[model samples]
Target chain A: MPRHAPIELEKFVPYQLSIVSNTVSEDIAREYRERFDLGTTEWRVMAVLARYDGDGLSARAVARLTAMDKVAISRALARLVANGRVLRRTHRGDKRRSVLRLSAEGWRIHDVVAPLARQHERAFLERLDADEQRALARILDKLLATDAAVR
Target chain B: MPRHAPIELEKFVPYQLSIVSNTVSEDIAREYRERFDLGTTEWRVMAVLARYDGDGLSARAVARLTAMDKVAISRALARLVANGRVLRRTHRGDKRRSVLRLSAEGWRIHDVVAPLARQHERAFLERLDADEQRALARILDKLLATDAAVR
Candidate 1:
């Protein structure tokens, strides 16, 4: 019988990345859900809008920037719009199209949530020494750039 | 007016981690979906079962091992069982509860998929030098351990 070596899920880089990302994301998502009744996708859209501020992004632009599925982004946008967290307006540049931005309420949430998100990131980074933190950031950049090149 | 700095999404650690993880996972998932018609959760459950091999794991055990939602795990198990890729038998230690293991077909799929998964990991790691690779692994361990401690 040929010996098949089992892949150790714990040591698997991709699996580890997934778990770590999911954990961090879930923790942040929990805060958003509990405090603001925002789902993961919705909060992500809000975050992008918060970043863009006055320069509203099209749904297509949001999808591209976030690298999220179009359908998921659309759904999140709908929920946000319905709940009055996001405002959709006709694009001034293109009358045929629309763009999305956070409402005053949305900015209020983003102002609070963005800082909280930063706090969580700081807490996570504090576990590592300065060297490890630098390495992690550099490694992620390389990996992300490489992945982006392929896509 | 006090200016609130907009988080540079591109530089944000958590957002970068998420985008990288999602890209890698989505790429791998595309392969699995195309080749084996497997969902991410299903492949994850299969990987866990393949690791255990003969000693089957209960659904709850699989959930714990994967750190996945119980509902998602259950749904994946159902799909696997329905597709005849996994076998569910009453636990030997406790007759009331059931345990899951890969069937012969499941093992066949695992044998093929495991190597493919390793290939993807290797390809991703090839972008980094030896030091970067080692640093990434160590950094992930630290981050994962710290995150785990909180939960």
Candidate 2:
């Protein structure tokens, strides 16, 4: 008789974490839709440009910040371009590479979303006191920085 | 001049954690692709059923376990049924409700994946030490158990 397979539901920490995260993200996406009329990726792009500093990173930086795929970011940026939420301009001396920036509407969206995002965060982290939230963020960032551990 | 958008990234601890979780899940998905012939959902479904009771839950339960949508799970279970990875049968009294259980091959796949999933988790959580892993798991489970906090 073969051994009974282990229960994966509670055993895999990563899967559990992902489940919680996805649930939280879906809530955020739904809330964002209600407030901003933007897709998840579109809002993510604007959020990235809100952090943009004329670094010419385009969709690459957005993906880095949001943990989205390059293809997904590219598609989101294309939509932004179509909707005039983002602008793509030639770099000062580089033709092949284009620098992407937020347009006026993108800024408007970001402005509207920032406070709501903060409130959402507050609601989600309400169970955790400030110190606990800070501690969790520190630990998560440390884990994220350790490539060998995660890789 | 438009006002500079507020910091979107720093506003939410849960949002940041979700992005970190996405990073880890993507890493796990990449690892699975390199080692298994199964797609992401296929691997997840098998894993979900590995520990599930043979009493057979509805496809919705499986979807919740796998974090997959009902339509997607519908399609995947259809494929799994055709491939003999799963047994989809209606209850004796109720034919409209389909109950799902793992077939032998599904069990085999689950056996193969358990260690791989654990390896990925052990490596990722190694940074936090065993005690910290337990702590993190407890906190995450608490959050997940809170229905309003989840999504």
User: Highest lDDT, which number?
Assistant: 1
lDDT of 2 at A51: 80
- Which stretches of model 1 miss by more than 4 angstroms? none
Instruction: Give the share of true interchain contacts found in each model.
Output: 0.75, 0.61
- Residue B143, candidate 2: Cα error in Å is 1.0
Q: Residue B99's C-alpha lDDT in candidate 1?
A: 84
The residue-by-residue lDDT of candidate 2 on B7-115, one tens digit each, is: 6564456666776677677777787667755667777777777777669878888888776789988887888888788888897888878988888887776677777
Q: Ten consecutive residues with minimal summed lDDT in candidate 2 chain B? A: B2-11
TM-score of chain A for the candidates in order shown:
0.92, 0.81
Grade the docking of candidate 1: medium
Q: Which stretches of model 2 miss by more than 4 angstroms?
A: A55-69, A148-151, B1-5, B8-12, B33-35, B64-68, B148-151
Candidate No. with top DockQ = 1
> lDDT of model 1 at residue B18?
88
